[model samples]
Target: MTHEPSGLKIIDRFSISLVRCEKRPTSPFGCKVGLRSVIIHSVLLCSSFKKSRKYSDVGKLNKINFDSLKRPDYVRTLTIRCRHLSRKESNPAAGVFRDFRNLDRLEIDRCHLKSLPSALFSGLQNLYSLVVKNAKLSVIPLDLFAYTPNMMTLDLAGNELRIEPYALRSLRNLIHLDLSNNSIDFVTNTLISLTKLKVLTMDNNRLTNIDFRRLPKTLTDLSLRNNFITTIHYVSGSVRNLRRIDLSGNRLDFIAGSGSINMLPPSLRQIDLSNNQIAFIEDKSLAELKMLAVLNLKDNQLTELKVESLSGPENRLRLLLGRNPFKCHCGIRWLIHSTEKTYPVVLDLSELNCSSLLNDNQKLSLTVADQRNLLICQYDILCPTSCICCDKPVCSCRSSCPPKCRCYRSANMESAQKTRNVVMCEKMRFDGSEEIPDTITELQINSVQLEQWDIKKLQKLRALETIRISNTSITDDQANSLYSSRVLMELQLSSTNITKVPSNIGNLSQLILIDNPLTQLTNGDISVSEIFPQSLKLEKNQL
Candidate 1:
């Protein structure tokens, strides 16, 4: 017997067992043994598994015939490569890989195949894994995997496949399936037949929404990152075994939840909702997510987070709350207290910042154990006289002649929709120095004296919507600027001295101008002809 450095070259008098080449073989290699029993028991894998080979320009072989090799059934693993050729010349004949009956693993790279026959993987009853990547395969036949029922892993990533439903129904025992980097748009009931599937990945697709109830119940890890998904729906007990779900880089505007009915599955342990457009989270949204351990809400549009919004299981949830425009108020002190306690620790606590309107619109850095007392509620400093303001739904002064304003316990404006605070100052006058709270939505000022009304302060109210300024003279400039508010919907200027309507009414749904001393609606270029409101009340105004 003699050995060479290039590869193993066995030369015996009775038989020739195998001839394996190292890298870039210049000639054909073969294996032949004297006895059939020796061929079945000895020569196992006689080819390079993952090596690159460049074909010579002389022979220019386009395909391989495993039948010509001695003891082809003894080969346990095989890797075929088609390099340096046009896409049209790289396709191999159908059933060319059927001779290796005992193959355990097979990989075909850069084959540029457009489709596969129904019986392409026939007779490979012992195959455990198969990988066909970087090919042009678009449509897979329904019965493609009928003969490979024992296959455990199937990876067809980097292909052009838009899989049809029941395309892989024959592989009941498939454990992991990676269909990433494809053009699949919808996957409704596409993978429900894989009863034993554990992990599934469909990243970088064109998926816009997903229903988890149609997925296989045995799946544990699911990743649908980098898609156009806007909403996800999953009922309880639908995906009972799912643990981790990654939905990063999507267009989700809010986490799906209501009072008690939410879209969270009970068995989820970790959820990644980072880099989305989530601006609101419903109260008790996470109450049913008892097994959750990690929650990521970074780089979103959240203005504030309520304590009830984060109330769910007793588990210490690890949070990621960085890069959000949080409003620095007393409502966010719960999060600061949680961070100070070090239970349910924020992973990116140092990267958090909040903007304060009372502090001259400055950005406040949020460090651990800092800014605990700096947060204040809207009514704590700007409450009106003879009116009690508390962070509850009902105030004690509501039984008086004038209705008292209610303060929302939550921080943000959208938190308490049903119980918004409405400040009422009837039959009173302000000294043009007292400021209204920014948290109030509706302001009712009746019979008040105001010759120096601040127009800038009215525009700075982020949540102000309805204004009822009665029995006060409204200057033309102030009236024009007030009508130009982007957020105001209803403006009641009843009994106020006004002559002309502002040209820039700006999408107001309702406009009231009753009992005003006006003869003709004209102010320079201001024309009331173009004004169109859904409901306009001009009963007592002079025309």
Candidate 2:
């Protein structure tokens, strides 16, 4: 009496409250109860009902028990919430959705319905969203939705659905379909015909293979999680145009991008292949994913990952590579000291765990950046050592590291690989006539120890670009070789007793002379008089 004075009905025994009244006919089959929403609290929904059923009358309202019944023919929205009734409970009836004419949204969750009559929903002409889940229905009865052609979203998860070909051919407007946590295995033309479909979720199914070539190109998001998918076959030049796809919890060992072509469409932005059996990805195939921005490869087998390989100018990808057994060795040095400009670097670098060869359970992790330095790290090579006659895999300290020297990448190299680099041979660690690595592109030293560093050895690094020397003294012979050096664009000298400029040093872009007493310009030491080349910036010195 307090709620709706005329058309509204609020039943306390059955816990049904109708919201927002819309005036319509009050007939048995007419949709004119004036209620916009129907909330059924405790109602025994049966498979069938007799005609003109009006068992419970609120006009005779007092304390009512179960078995309250109504025609419910005009209900526009209906929900049956029985979490304890998800299995088949037989009830002799003709059909469930017999006279629901104006129903737009219907949910039958947590109900045990063994089968549905073909014409169960033959009366719903305006239904848009249908969710029939947590039911033990193994098969979708033929033509069950033939009358409800206006359904937009079909969520039938937690059901034993053996999806057959053309199972959803009647749903032309359905865009989002969630059949996750079902027993449906392989996919057929059962779904490809829905050209308008954009998102499909079939996670936790028994699927083995999904023919990528036949998949709908119009689909933007597809999820096939927790399946037995090992190989994904697609054709060349005909890759699916998806924005995101999740294939997590599969049995994939390698990602070779299918036959004859390594192509992932440019439309794809994120891919999740986590918790799979993936050992490695083909490098050539990865580069084909040109537009990927986020990649998840967690809980897989990956040892040496060149971070630059997964990203480039076209794709600056963030990677999730946690829970993989990583070797703490030189193979991953490129990831540590790489100079290449890989964009959107991995944010989860801290989770990169290490498994050493000596003791797999030794609880080792990636050495901190400082400990990664070869000069400071290789001394102990705490990892198991191997001398494999040079044909060994990368990350073997004995195979890659020189006896003792800290190596760093060259500034010009723009990859996450340490292929082109320089070495720092501190004066204290220098012994006379040490063979400087031919790979060193720029050399730096604190003292002019020509006998130990061998200034003439600089000619070996044809790629050398810069040199910094805090010299104790520069001999005449050293100055002659230094001035004629043609590979240098920058040169720096810092010495308290020294002062000089190379005659032919105009070819240098920048010449930094730091803290030197240069009162005189003669005595084989030339000082700047007026000006020099355009690219030179002469710093503090005793003029």
The candidate that wins on TM-score is: 1
Off by over 4 Å in 1: 1-21, 24-62, 65-68, 81-86, 259-262, 339-343, 358-361, 368-374, 380-449, 452-543
Per-residue lDDT of candidate 2, residues 394-418 (tens digit): 5432322244555554222333443
**Deviation (Å) of 61 in candidate 1:** 2.3
Q: Please, what is the TM-score per model?
A: 0.64, 0.57
> Worst lDDT window (10 residues) for model 2?
58-67
How much lDDT does each candidate structure score?
Answer: 0.67, 0.60
- Which whole-number lDDT from 0 to 100 does residue 326 have in model 1? 83
Task: Give the lDDT of residue 310 in candidate 2.
Answer: 62
What is every candidate's alpha-carbon RMSD to the true fold? 11.8, 16.7
Across 1-543, the per-residue lDDT of candidate 1 in tens digits comes to 333334444444455454444443211111111111112323233343112244434234433434435556766666655554435434345565577787777777666776677787888888888888777678887888888889988888878867533667889889988888888888878688899999888888788888887789999999888888887877667779999998888888887555223266768889888988889887777778788899899988888887777677577778898998887666766675664332466788788888753434777776521333334455533333456654446565332222233232223323323324456665666544245565566777778776677767777867778887788767777777778888788898988888876666675788888888867666532344444634465668788
